[model samples]
Target: MRKRVAVIGGGIAGLAAAVRLRDLTPPDTEIIVYEQSGALGGKLRTGELGGVTVERGAESFLMTGADGAESAAVALVKRLGLGDAIRHPARVPAALAFGGRLAPMPGGTLVGVPGDLAQLGDVAHADAERDHDAGRPLLAEGEDVAVGALVRERYGDEVVDRLVDPMLGGVYAGRADGLSLQVTMPQLARTARVEHTLRDAVRAAQRAGRRVPGKPIFGAVEGGMSRLVGAAAAASSARISLGLPVREIARTAHGWRLLLGPVPAPQTDDVDAVVLAVPASPAARLLSGVAPAAAAALGALDYASVALVGLALPPGTPLPDLSGFLVPPSEGTLVKAATFVTTKWSLPGDGPVIVRASLGRAGEQERLQFDDAVLLERAMSDLGALLGGELPPPVASWVQRWGGGLPQYAPGHLDRLAAARAALPPGLALAGAAFDGIGIPVCIASGERAAEDVSKAWEG
Candidate 1:
């Protein structure tokens, strides 16, 4: 009998799993991908605004090193022969909306944690005595802390609210105070536990020659992140079914069976192994009966909502040449961050300058409830303030809402995942942003790991 593997979900994680299964499994082994929606990429949406391709979901992936070659995302792109399509952002540093002025981001910082307080010009500093003193540890051994709390404790509220919040907003769309240091920023977390000061810790680490030098920190596909999804789907020989929602998963005589389609007319597929690569909520519901403990843990996970509003400014509109700016929550503005798409990426057509604003967060869903027009107005208002003047109306605009899109990585997330895995059935695996990470590369890695686990179980 031919072995069969069913991958539930068509997002990056699921696609990565299916691709790996096709590559690793025998010729007779069958691989199938089931996507609930018409589209394959979950949050990797790309579309045209003013005849130019622009990203609505995730836009880029962080390189593993300065070299940009070792990341799983890059490797996947190369494997799919998309190496030429890779694009790097212009060498421009982002600015922070500080005190109603655009301020350059201080050098020597790790995700908003300042390695040299001297670089931060009056953005709040730690007590000189405590900062220089030894024996004072930011974290005790084995102690997990929130990223926000740790940064605030060491540098003060100004640093966390200004530097960290904007960076966190760009990625998680959730508050830093609610995210785990160990899970969200593991390297910093490890360093924080032993070091007395962030500056000293950064210096010591750099001196130890642990950091990769002269590597591109981030990269994206030429068209958009959606290109990566398209390439992944086309590369694999796996059977794909779109708009087929998996309603149930049950253990069968030989393996697992998935109930698909609407309730009135359901279809079923029996496979030797299964991978649950959807978000936490749906994955929890799927595992409720089979893995009760895992379901409980997954159900406890929370998510954040956000809206990306794209605006096409009239040509020759006066604007800063920088990439973008991050608005700290302390600014009490509707806009969280802005990405100057035209400045960062290569657009296809000679369209108006493109800029996108991200609004809302885990607890700030009310702003997302506003109508598209209202959201556009609010984003423009913030942009005008940051740009130092009022601007003309947009020639083109696009609004994309992602409700419950980003999963919150609260403290102790790792422990919760461990518990969930302990309760999963044999020949079954879970992979998605809600697990270990929420980025493109991390999700790909998660899917690959799940495929490896299932393959090993089948072989053993």
Candidate 2:
């Protein structure tokens, strides 16, 4: 029989790994993809409201480095004929909500840390200005520091409370302190790795001149991220079994065995190799018996629950003058950030504007419980203050919830990740946001690499 491989989880990591395995292995190699959920693409889902599209999960992908991994994402998108569906070539006027106003992120700021310190002090508060001049690096440059603490130290409390914390909170749907800087802002760590100052690293990136995707910006895909997920599913040759949750993974003499089926209807699939690509906590639960060490390491990582409140406004609705708003850690508001989706993307026609307000990160998950109607009311009320108008209620509304979606890459994350991968057995591999990166590109890379590692060992 041909070598058989089993991939658990249907998110980008598992899906990408399965497709790439088909690409690299012998034509008859057998691969099976199991997704507990009925659909694929994990968190990369999009919503439609009265002809408008809203991204409830990932908002955009930061393009960087033409590394083999990055190239794979581009190739996948291109293969799916999604080149035109990409909405942006780079980052746009992503602003910080400070003192109740939108402030354009400082020019040349990399991951909220200034690469050029000459103008950094100019935009900062009086106290933080002193810290930056003294080169205190208010944020920890190498080790993991609470994102809020680092921003406060470098730019003063105002920047952290108003801009940095809220902005990150929205993206991660978790508290800044609870989230690790290494996983979320590893780019800044490069400065610490090569030199002591992030300012120096920015200079280095500038000298290197556009390391990723032939562009040095961030972007969103067109027609929504959902289409990308569907396309990948369509291209796969693997036997995909959806809604089939695996209860346990066990080691077998010939290969490995999966104890699957919801209680009262259990079945099994024994394959030559296995890939655990679910969220960290759940992955840990499934792997406790086969690889105790891998399970322990995965379970150690923190995850956050998050919710998105999407609103569909009528055509010609006037928006508050603010371009977009972020919630700093100090805001004491349930809302972490709000996106002006219409301004951020191109509309097909003059239709209703789509807006997304993010709520609940970690400790704030309870706030997501105000009930849907009440939740929308609260979101809009808070939005009104920032938008400054009695806009009509949304023509449509969608509420989506993700439990333990984004992984909190606390400080020393890379070290821990290396430790986890090192502990896995030779024929076994790990993938998904639980490892190196959480974005679609990062997860896809993890999947491809895992397949390569396993394939190399199997062939030998």
Candidate 3:
């Protein structure tokens, strides 16, 4: 019998799952990817401005994992024949904006949790005395806590507000007080399980993942992220169905049945296995009847909305020498982070200087309701203020808004996901940023793992 697998959602995660299924399953196995949106790359969109390429979504990904091994994303790039296209950012430090000035971001910090307290010079004050050993490990086995709660207790509010929050915000569009330590900073969380002090835990986590000197931590495709996405999609060889939402899924005697397309004119697909790679809400709805517990748990997860503004300044624009800066929420500004795209990346042409500003944090959806022009103006204003002078009008500008894009992994997220996975029936698997930690590498690994799980079930 010829086997068939359906991957719901055409984002990078789903696409990665399709590729893995093609690799692991028999040559005759049919792999189909159904995406609700017309586009394939979810948050990896690449755009153009002032005749230069720019990333409208995610710009780069970590090149290596915690074990100093090639990250899943980098591996996927190589597997898809994109290894040569990988471009590392220029060696320039980033800064943190606070107290009406910019200061170099502290080094030796695990997502802004200082490994050595003395490194926090003027960025923020760390309460050294509070880090005294607490007689036992900071966390018991199978326990989790918010990153902010743990850091604030040991360091102080200043460190959490100035350093940790901005760093996390740039990644998750979420505050440290809400993100789970186990999900966001797993290395530190692991060390906290056996380490008696927070500082010691940070140091231990840093030591475990020490990188070779001069090695670049992040990498991007030479052209744009879309190249990576397009390459992965082509390599998958999956039958692509775009703009079709999978309405529901139910177990069948032979395999699984999927309800897709519009309500009045619905479509059905029968496959040997199914991978749900959509966001939390839609995934929850699909699993409501089949895996109610999993649906409930997935439904409980919230998301953060954000917008990215790109500006292309004329040539010879005198910007700061740094890559960019992060704005803490305490700054009470609309812009949370800005990236100097031209300065950071080694683009080929002498194009205009490019700057990208990220705005809106978790629980700030109302702030993003403005029109594109309004949002762009606000971003420009914020950028000018941070630079201590008004910026020249850009030769080109672009705005991209993502509604409820980032998943907020609350404490106990991993435990709830485990229970949900346990409750799922055979032949059904979940993958994507909603289920695992965010980031290109993590999502790729999640999708591959899901593909493997479904393959095992099919074999059994």
Error of 2 at 411 (Å): 1.3
| Residues 1-460 of candidate 3: C-alpha lDDT, one tens digit per residue | 8999999998889989999999999999999999998999999999998999899998899999878899999999999999999999999889999876778899989999998989899888988999989799999999999999999999999999999999999999999999999999999999999999999999899888888898889999888999988998899899999998999998899888999899999999999999999899999999998999999989999999999999998877878888999999999999999999888885543689999999999999999999999999999899998899888999999889999999999999999999889999988999999998899999999999999999999899
lDDT of 1: 0.84
RMSD of each: 2.1, 3.3, 1.0
- TM-score, candidate number 3: 0.99
Native-vs-model 3 lDDT? 0.93
Candidate 1 has what TM-score?
Answer: 0.95
User: Pick by TM-score: which candidate is best?
Assistant: 3
Clashes of 1: 2
Backbone clash total for model 3 is: 0
Residue 123 CA displacement from its true place in model 2, Å? 6.5
lDDT of 2: 0.71
lDDT digits (tens) for residues 219-283 of candidate 1 = 89887888889889987788899999998899987789899999999999999999999999999
Clashing pairs in 1: 66-215, 67-215
Per-model C-alpha lDDT, please? 0.84, 0.71, 0.93
Error of 1 at 122 (Å): 2.8
